[model samples]
Target: MNLRLRSNAIMAVAEQLVVGITFFVLYGVLIRSVGAEQVGILSLVLVLTSVGQLANIGFGSALLRAIPMHEGRGERHLSIASIETSALCSALFYGGLLLIAYYPFQYLITIQAGPQYAPTIAAMMVPATINVFAMGLGAVSTAGLSSIMRNDLRAVANIVGGILCLAIVFLATPRYGVVAGFWALAAQSIFVLLATWLFLYRQLPGLHLIPRRLNRTVMRDLVKVGYKLQLQSLLVMALEPLSRLLIGHFGTLSQVTYFSMAARYVMQMRGIVYSASQPILSAFSYLRESDPARQQQLYATFSTVIGLAAIAMLSATAAAAPFVGELWIGKREPLFEGFAILQSLGWLAVTVILGSYFNAYSLGFLRYNLGSHVVMAVANLVLGVALGWAFGPWGVVVALTISLVLAGLIMGIGNARFQPHGSRFLSLSNMATLALGCAAVGTAVAGYHFVRGYWPMLASGLASGVIWAAVMLPAFAFHSERGLILNLLRLRIKRRG
Candidate 1:
């Protein structure tokens, strides 16, 4: 990546880290106040409502690719129209559809989470449904900002919204239970939605969300590209929510909380890296037709960085799982530790192999991408159902873990087919180093059982860091992308000096 793109990625990562940490703290408060079962209900509500993204019909995904392409060709009007049209359609169409589906949605909660939780889930959905409406407004705005390389502005909006969510959830949960979480969601959505539009309006001379600005042709093309992307993502995105549902169905509400708890921590922590890497989508889209060789070079470097970061982060987190769980909820639970460790490893597979490929898919490889999702979704459903039925929570997690690794490797094979000669997603030596890092971290985590409290946390974390630096840093130092990164760092340091 170039210096400008790298800096944007860093800002994006900072935004995600702050926002993630804010909500993570709120979840901790919820656990202390309302108990794990209530937290489980909240998790289910959030997961169920996430399906509302279908209302946008993939326009958000399309905007990321289409707007950038349109702008590159100097079609500013088309770019403006695309954003306005997507936002307008999402609010008008998605709101009505979600409200109409409220009862069925409640029924889904009843079946998945339990009947007793249905009433609270219903109460929560009232606000969550409204939040869905606002999402229509926010989605295009968010995408527009990123496509324009204004992630710094988007990050500001997100951080402020997160703080608002933390405040609302903190103040209301003790009195209103998990329902408070939905109210907070509604508030945060509206705030961020407004902030994003205001920012876009300021950045783009003629941007507007008014109906008059919505172009029929832009809307049509957005759906043309978006629905296909949305269709592919619908099943792929269900992996986590479905895993939680399985936990709720076969196990208990508390089990759902445990699973989601671990997942929330890992996903949020990893979001920093994911958000950091996201600029590649815009960068790739910008260069897809214009510069194939440069695009390949960027992809190779990014893929390596993603893998190394995933290993370093996930391995350290897995080793410190017990400590994290204790600190997160004010107590230690073995299940939380197991869930964190398992999920860390699972997401590491995703981040390392499949990280930038989804963004690459936006460069027009949906057929290959769709095939990978099919492979993953099928593996998840088959293994998840069979194992979940046999062994309970552990079975569900193990199923997810295996499905991720299996599908990711398959995707890696497909991604390689498109690569330039002598470029690989993961080199054999780096792969070996990654394997060694995992093994070292696993050993450290295993040894944590012999110790207790903060000692294990510190020791395991330090040991993982040491192992990563010794093994992984050398790989980075010798890799092809090292020059780009080192040069960027040196430029920044030189400027400071």
Candidate 2:
């Protein structure tokens, strides 16, 4: 089972990379043809999205938990009521809030871009906000699918959406400007909403829509689950976007420009592992420790494979960062020189990967550390803003790195207490090993910058990724540590034979 989980993690990462790169590549092309001014409204719209997702408050996680268990245990009606009731109410609430937010978008625009772009920005936020609401209609179900690892279906929808969005951006954006991007996004939302509903309805079949007689029990359950997750949502909201806001205000738009583009690639790489981790982490952490073998299952599944894959990818991306900024964005410019923020926040990627199970352990036991998540986010945001004000973009970067290290440490302690029986791996030596590896990989890649030409540097950086992965894989796969995993697989194969 651990072997399967590891394999699944790799496949999911591969799919995410292929699908995500398609979208980013198209976006890069569009940005090249028509500078950030033409389609930059998307970033502002993303600001609203970050808020809207928090507003979801873990409805997706709760929905995922409810449905499959109910299906397996034969509580179809209850499951249907839970999914639909949650989805419809979520849509109504977020949609209306977004609509109400329209008039005030001028305020948001003024904060970000000042009065000159404020009016046009306000206009764009309207459709984008509505699209956000439309997304709420389907997203809970998708989250459930992801939790169950039935994300092959969701991934298909994503791939399709990415392709459509690419065509929409290229064909419409250049001719129509930023408005085309918004309109295409709205259309894309409509496409996915229909797809999500159809998929869920087919799977559940007896699912019904009961707007008039809302199930109080289902609503209560949703709240029970969402409240625990709300802290996570809130913390993510406060911390994730602070750097951008800080950079935009204190530094030049070009600084915000370089950091934003570089950060996107970094974030996307981190996101692939995160996507795979979320679902399985929940499932594994819930296994009974009375089953000692299952404890080993958790370690083999998580520490051995997932950790190595994340480290390898992190190394590859850190090495390739300069090439992405200098050549990939289409023009050779000094935009590649200042990546301190990118490098600093890159540490968070490791924290995110190593600390993957921290939240799941808390939530699985119903410890509901919303207060902790909120506290960490607030501390990070406050420190980030203060430092950003004092020192500029680097300040925010430094603050974020400090915050994540503390956050990861805090969560590591809490998670150990939450599940002492599992084969826990958040020791000081382990962290030291990870840090040393990051330094070595980061230093080797830094040398590529001295190549003095984009084309040569890009080629070498790409090749270096292969070299690092080759070295990391054997050190991991043949570990004396997981001798049992190798033996168990052999037994299973012999038994089948």
Candidate 3:
């Protein structure tokens, strides 16, 4: 990647990390003040709102893919018109869904979560739903900006909006409770929308914020590309809510709190991977036409980095779960339960990171096959629900883990056979390194469990880190893109100096 893109990726990851930590702190406060049940209700509310993204109808990804191609082909007017039209359509679609489902959503919440949550849920629903609409609009602007290589502006907007959202949630949630958080989210969404629009307008002088017509031609093209994308979106959107709902039904709201907390931590780690890889996906798309060899090199570098980083983070999380959990939640058992869940689901993180790398490669090359994505989505939902029913929250995670592994294997095989011939596949050496990494993680977890105390956990973590660096770093540096990795480090060091 070029310096500008690399910097943008770093900024995006840093913003997400900061925002994630801020939310984590806020969640800790909410749990401490209002208790886990209230937090559980809040989690459910957030999940429902996330599911609202399904109303986007895959326009977000469609915009991302389409805007770049249109600009590349010098069809600037078409790109701008499509963005405006998609934004308008998304807002209308989501708004209408909210209106129709308002009463049904309320009834569902009351029946599942109980009467105590009804007022808060009712109060938050409108703003949260509005937030979804704002997010849809923001997606278009963000995609346009990114496609034009202005990702830095998008990162800045997100950071600023995140800070504002954190402040709102911090001040309002304590006094006004869960409803305040939803309003804060809505505010954050509007901030991002305005920021992205401002940056986008500056970047593209000819861009139109309002379309003169509906542009049926653009809409038809987007829909043709988006139908399969929307199915994937629906599957992704439904996973979390379904898992949480099952926990509520099969276990309890309290279990939802535990599971959501663990899942949040895992998701944040996954977010790091996503933020870092996203820019590369855009680069890959450009390289596909200009430099196929460079595209392959970038893919290998990105996949290696993603895999190694995920292993390190998840291992450390597992090793230090006791100390971190006690510190964050002020209770040992529930947090430990969350850790156990993480332990069982740790490999799932690696699989997801790898899967994302493959998907991005495929999308960039315009060779993405929807069949595997569809299968994985369906399998995940079925397995998640069935496993949750059979063995509770842990089972849901296990099901997800299995589904992800299966998907990864299937995709990996397909990539090896059908993707460009020279594209790197996981070799025996890489597999061996991964196995050793897993063993190191297991050692860390075991050491922490047997030794106990903060110091022991710290020691275990340090030892695991050392082992990973010693074994995996050398393996990657020697076996993969050594020059690229060395150059990246040198650049960072030079910048620091």
Candidate 4:
């Protein structure tokens, strides 16, 4: 990567790390102070907001694609106007939906949390709704910044906003409860918008946000491309929230807390992989156009590294859940149940990481396989609901895992056919690496069980780490691209030097 891209990637990782840690700490505090039920309320509201944000009708991504193209053609003013108009429309549409859904949402919350918590739930919704609108407006500015290759600014803005949110939540949740937490989130979203606008202004002093005539042609183009994307989003975005909703309705609020916390922890771990991989998507796209052979090779390497990394990270996390829970939640036993759920769904997480690369490959080749996405979406919803109802929280995760694996296989096969010959999904070496990684994880788990004290547990964890390294380093050195790992390590050392 060039210096600019490298810098942006580093900043992006930092931003995600900061935000992840903030939320992690914030959730831990909330769980300790207000109890699991209040945390469930907050988690439910946040999920609802995320699902509702899709009402933007996919214009957020549309603008990201459109802005760059227009800027390349020197139609910057028109692009700005077009994005602004789309954002305005999205905000209005989302706000209208929020208004319409308010009473019904309140009714559901009342049923779930009882009439005593109803007022708190209602108060939380006010800022939550405003946060959704703030996000809509901020999307336009962030898209513009990304198009101009100032994507690092977006990361910086997020870091600032996240810290502010953390502070607000920390200060307010003690006295005011969940309502104050939602208000903190609202402030964070608003800050993100302001920070993004400031960065955009700095980058393009001549750019204006004033309302302009709606460019019908641009609107039509965005809608044409966006509506198809929105269909997939509508289906996919509903899965997680709906799963939690089911848990909330069928199980107790405490179950919702367990389910959400486990899912959130796993998702945050996945985010680390995502942060590393996302920057490469554009690189992959560029290589597809300029160097198809190189693109195929890099895709193979990236998929292997990402898949193995996810397995290692998640397995390690699962093994250390006891320690983490001890520190974060004041009890290790309470976390075991959630950790079990994560363990049951471990392979699914790896596949989800790999599937992201596959999806990027499809996009890089300009092949949007709508059918594949549609199938994945449908399977997720149907299986998630059915299995969740039948088996409970773990069942929902099982359903998601099965759906993702099936969808990933379909997409992988499709992508392989498009690549040159000899491009395999799981090369022999890759499979061996995965096997050894799993073995290492099993060793760690066994050690945790057989060992007696904290000192022994620490030693076992260390031994497991050493064993994984011993196996993986040699495997990568001899089986795959020779010296690739060593070269990366040396380069990192040199950079530090």
What lDDT does each candidate get?
A: 0.75, 0.59, 0.66, 0.64
Model 3 lDDT, full chain set: 0.66
TM-score, candidate number 3: 0.87
TM-scores across all candidates?
A: 0.91, 0.85, 0.87, 0.84
TM-score between model 1 and native: 0.91
Model 2 worst lDDT window (10 residues) = 488-497
lDDT string for model 1 (1-497, tens) is 12257678778988988877877787888888888988888888887566876678888888888876776566888888888888888777787887788878778887777677767877887898878778767887898899877898999998899889889988898789878888987898899999989999998887753545667888888888888788776866688888988888779888889888898888887787778877777776766645656666666666666766677777777767766787787777888989988888877777776444744465576666667677777888888889999999899999888877776676677766655443344567567657766776666665555555446556654654454456456666665555645543432210010
* Candidate number of the best TM-score: 1
Q: Write the per-residue lDDT of candidate 2 for residues 58-130, one digit (tens) a residue.
A: 6766765555445434466877777777776787778677767766755875678766777667667766776
Once model 1 is optimally superposed onto the true structure by TM-score, how far is the C-alpha of residue 235 displaced, in angstroms? 1.8
Pairs with backbone N, CA or C atoms under 3 Å apart (clashes), candidate 2: none
- Among all candidates shown, the one with the greatest lDDT: 1
The candidate with the higher TM-score, 1 or 2, is 1
1 against 4, candidate with superior lDDT: 1
In lDDT terms, how accurate is model 1?
0.75
Error of 3 at 249 (Å): 0.7
lDDT of 4 at 119: 73
